[model samples]
Target chain A: MSDLADLYRDVVLDHARTPHGFGLRDGAAAESHQLNPTCGDEVTVRLHLGPEGAIEGISWEGHGCAISQSSASILADLAPGDSPEQLRSRIAGFRAMMRSRGEVEGDEALLGDAVVFQSASRYVARVKCAMLAWVAVEDALLKLG
Target chain B: MSSIAPTIAAATALEESEVYRLREDFPILREQMGGHPLVYLDSAATAQRPVQVLDAEREFLTHLNAAVHRGAHTLAAEATEVFEQARETVAGFIGARPDEVVWTSNATEALNLVAYALSNASAGRGGPEADRFRLGPGDEIVATEMEHHANLIPWQELAARTGATLRIIHLDDEGALRLGEAAEVIGERTRLVAFAHVSNVLGTVNPVEHLVSLAHAAGALVVLDACQSAPHRPLEVKALGVDFAAFSGHKMLGPNGIGVLYGRAELLNALPPFLTGGSMITTVTLERAEFLPAPQRFEAGTQKVSQAIALAEAVRYLQRVGLERIEARESQLAVRLHSGVASLPGIRVLGPGLGVERAGLVSVVVDGVHAHDVGQYLDDAGIAVRVGHHCAQPLHRRYGVTATTRASTYLYTTEAEVDAFLERLAGVRGFFGAAS
Candidate 1:
């Protein structure tokens, strides 16, 4: 493993171990059920959009293998105050990162530890597993709009 | 590294020298995947064809390029000779009379012929055999939880068409069939007992003679799905005493669009044809069409002649190795593969463990990693394996998993391939950070 990969693995482990918001949002703005049919991973993400239409709080609850659960945790931690436009770019950046197409050119600092999984892109099949939670978040945000 | 092919060495020592040499015949095994030699562990889906089979096909299309049983010309005679010769080869390979074999698009169609015949009987369209196959209220069709969809669903459809009931033999935690319970279920009501000889997913080898005995005692016809077994084992359908047997050519180093259905001559002569068209008719009038004998009555429309010729060559190749030797060689490889995968931490095998009863597969769940991820990791490493339910969802449910990664083997597989797969699997969970 490269030095950068080692650093990334640590970041993923940290977010996976201690997620930000992982319960049902008491008064959420939008929610959706997400399933990775390929791997049988399922998650339900609920979001709370603020009065100004920015992501206020997001949380999730689901059951799956570790990669999916950890990906969900990272998504929960990163959703706090971003507008819809910013999150769309994040989704695109995440797609590119997972594909290992180019450098992860988004605001890597704001990826808030979710960036660790960026190195996991090499294993093409697990990208869907690692992206399960983020997909659910993106879906919920689209529905919230 | 001694550069010794340990898998081949073990096979060569197993009284099957010819089978060991079959490795040199397949061209795909020499190709590289991810810069490493491709370790093809997915033969259960389809076996790689050898040069002889491919060349035979090319020769047939190049030289004997005409329709069979037609024209009364030399090309017609040559084409017909090639087609019938292939049939005789396949029939002899399985110890069935050549007249008993019927060709179809694939095994599913072959089985559907039997199932639909019974269905026609229940509807009162079947003739003298109607009483033999007719199933209505109180009649039963028995199978097991480990059946591939091709074997299971046909019976299910049969039961729904008639008022006949469908009963299943259950599998234990390790995926072996509960044969003792099967003895009780296959009673007088059973009109057909259909199942796979080797499960496509679990890789557990069922007791054919035992199962056939129970079905026969009840006066029921037995249908064996030899899709998984035929390619790996030395099978004598007559010895097994099955009334009908179905298998595909594609999975056994033959061409696609060709399959076999072998029936007891007496039973086939009695049943009605499920498909009726041009070549299958004995004679035709504006009022009705009289169908031909057993084999012809079932093979409707144009046939997979070239593909059938290729399949016959495949049988010849397997015969050169000797089926008994092939069975022994594969069983040893299966055990080594099982031990290798089973020893990996947190991995749970989905079928009968060890040498007690297994064919050529190992379906497994890595403790915390999803099957697709394991598949991808192995794919990245250039080691191809099957992932997901393996089209045996109910079997997966019985094992308490929605999906699993299956590493299947064949005559051409080597120990180094198994080692490559195992090494990559050991590092998989850690690669995805699921390793606790």
Candidate 2:
């Protein structure tokens, strides 16, 4: 039961229910669509960059499990106002944390609420659900480049 | 048209004590998962093998382990005899002739073999003997929207290779095939009709007789995806009048790496071989090769000897239990599963509704919760289930959902397991804070 609680944290459920930047918007510099074929989860993320290469806005639209939807919401909330290099470092840290299998207590200052997904790493099949949105955003960033 | 009638009387359901005795044969059923007794409801993905099946394969490897069909040594002869006998056992299980059953790696490979064979024939490989398989621009191959990718994709590739158009028989909201649309879709231009005997996602037993009649009337060959049906029901390929059918061993308490492609003897002989190599040939020249007839021609290289032997043992196990009784028991489980899931708030059960006949599986969608979360919750409760589009993306698309959580049963499933699953499932939406 504790393990289930760790996976479906209150904050995670809240974010999933009321996601940030949940709708696709016009005038984005680039977009990428990602799908987790194992469970048919999909996300389309669009990136809007400022003049100096900062993430001016990140918006996404997709349908999937709570972990995936909330992760996208966290990304949408935290990505703006960060430079491309900073966002890339955050993505790297998230990936490493997810792969650690609950061994790594993620740096909360860097990951914010996204660190809650560290519990998802314990279950191999749920790892993809936690990573789906991050992958979509990373692909969108590459498209902008 | 020589389908074997089921020998058992029409029993409504198995006794709980009988299911408990059957459970003793499966050693894994005793193991605990997540601190609770494991309630395996994912038999549609792959069934748990009995100790008898495991012992049979082990026994073969221990005593008569040798290459089949090539060597003349005593061990080789014994192995060859056992292998052929296994083929006969599987043939009788499905009411097929031993000559008509070809071994492949799995049902996917079996379907691909047929698709590629048709393409080869269309390319003028088998000469006039294979003319019936040839398809052109005007010809069409029909599949259902509810078909697993295994059944649909092969025909898609075949149509691409042979210039035949691929048509779909769409389903209604309840996942029932539109027989009216099927009548319109299968016509003079239709070359082949491919469909599943039972939907892996919907659990709807497709009207095989009606579909076969339609295809036969239009001079089209019918291929049945029997992966979900053969393991659960009394299947008779000859009685169904399908030109070809494919099923996997792993889903039927047998080992992986073994599947059967049952075809009409005449059609199989006339069709060009897909995979050609050593054992399948009669005469090989530097320029060309003459192939053996039917089964051997399709089964090239070394076969899955041990796995085939194990599958025959599984067929015998099912036979001993009686498929009719198994079907009756599973049908009762299906009713319990469907009603139990549907009774929950915000839950929607896919496929046939209450009182409707269906196979022994239930797929559900919680209005506010995703299937992965539901699956994770169930897993935490030690209830194993399948969560996905179930390899039938078009069917999921038709239902207007991305994924679903499926719980399937087999002959060994018990009432307590079903109750345990429902009890765990009832808490999923609430635990995820999605309950209204």
Candidate 3:
């Protein structure tokens, strides 16, 4: 049960139960739908940017595991008020952590509750689940430019 | 009365103890996964191979390894004999002639072979005889909504390539095909009707005889995807009256990289080869060349000789156990699984309800839980199941679900394993806080 507990931490469950910005926004300038074909999990991420290309708001709609849904919630909470440059670095850090094969210690200050997915890196099949929302946000941000 | 009834009764009686004995042959069943004894309920994805299948392949590679049908040397001749003999065993297992069985990479390629060949025919590759397969804008290709992507996509592509319309027979609420509409959909203009013998997702045992009759009535060829059925039931391609059928070896306890495509000899000979070059040619000049007759013409390049040998061993293993007995045992397992889960609150079982005859599998959706979470919970309990659309998205869409968690059984599956799976599934809603 330790492995399952490590993967489904309290913070992850909390975020999944009450995901931030779960509804779609009107006049969203950038959006992308990301699908994990293997599991059929899909997420459509929408981003509203401020004047300086800083993320003014973030929201998503999807049906997936707690990991993916919670990851999306955490992204919505963290992406707003960050400039595109800051968001890029944060995304890069998260991607690096996911690809670390459980070797790299996830940086909580940077990734926030999304750092709870560190244990998922050990399970090759689930890394994609943790990364689905992140990848969608990355795609949406790319569309912003 | 038919002799089939007595044989099934005897096999069912024997399988009461035979299934327990059969587990000893599969070594992996003894191992631990996720700190508990592994409960493999994902045989629909791919079956665990027995030591006999392993030994057969190893024996061939060690002693009889050589390029088949090529050389005058002793090893080459021996390999060729073994390869062709494996083909005979496979063909016999499905009640077809050895020449009617063409080997391919897997069932996916086997299906693509038929679709692509029909496309070739439409393009004037197989001449007049092949024109029976050709379709135009006014013509139609009939498929059911319950098809796996392997069975569905190829026909869709064929219809796209030709000007034929791709029509579907939709599923009812219980996931059964609305087969009453078959007469109307499979009209004279229908060139082909392809569907799964048993659905990978729903475990629905389709009315193959009825569907084949309808196709025949319209003078349309039938292509059966037996990936789910061939492993669990006794199949006779001739008796089923299908013009062509495709099934994979791995799902039937054989090695991967080997599959069989069964077709009527005349249709196969008329349909141009899907893959070309090497081994399949009868004569070769740079200017023009002639091809060999099927199943040789369909089998291009060096074949999966050892895998075919191992697959033959797998077929022999199933025969020794008796497919009827295996089917009987699995039906009981399916009943236990369905009834056990059906009693739980807020659990929606896909396909047929508890009492209907289905293949040895069940897929379900929890009221408030995602299938991935349910799958994770099961995995934690040492249960392995497939969680997704099960490669039948259109069927899942029809059921208004994005995904489902499925537990499928095999010849070696035990009552205890079914109980364990049900017990784990019973707790999924609670663990995810979806329970009332």
Considering every candidate listed, which one attains the maximal TM-score?
Answer: 2
Cα lDDT computed for each candidate against the true fold:
0.81, 0.91, 0.89
Best by DockQ: 2
Q: Over the stretch B232-301, how does candidate 3's per-residue lDDT look in tens digits? A: 8888889899999999999999999999999999899999889999999999998976889999999899
Go through the candidates in order and give the C-alpha RMSD of each one to the true structure.
5.5, 1.6, 2.0
Residues B75-184 of candidate 2 have per-residue lDDT tens digits of: 99999999999999999998889999999999999999999999999999897899878888999999999999999999999999888999999999887999999999
Q: Chain A only: TM-score of every candidate?
A: 0.82, 0.96, 0.95
Which portions of model 3 miss their true places by more than 4 Å? B1-6, B9-16
Chain A TM-score, prediction 1:
0.82
Model 3 pairs in collision:
none
Q: What docking tier does model 2 reach?
A: high
List model 2 lDDT by residue over A1-145, tens digit each. 4898988899899999999999999989889999999999999999988988799989899989999999999988889999978888889899999999989888888888999999998989988988998888888778767
In model 1, where do residues sit more than 4 Å from their true spots?
Answer: A1-145, B1-20, B285-287
Q: Rank the candidates by TM-score, best first.
A: 2, 3, 1
When 1 and 3 are scored with TM-score, the better candidate is: 3
**DockQ of predictions, in order shown:** 0.28, 0.90, 0.77
For residue A130, model 2's alpha carbon misses the true position, in angstroms, by: 1.0
* Residue B153 in model 3: lDDT: 96
Candidate 2, residue B349: Cα displacement in angstroms equals 0.8
In model 1, what is the error at residue B297, expressed in angstroms? Answer: 2.0
Candidate 1 lDDT over B116-201, as tens digits, reads: 98888778876665576778988999988998878989989999999999999999887888988999999988888998999999
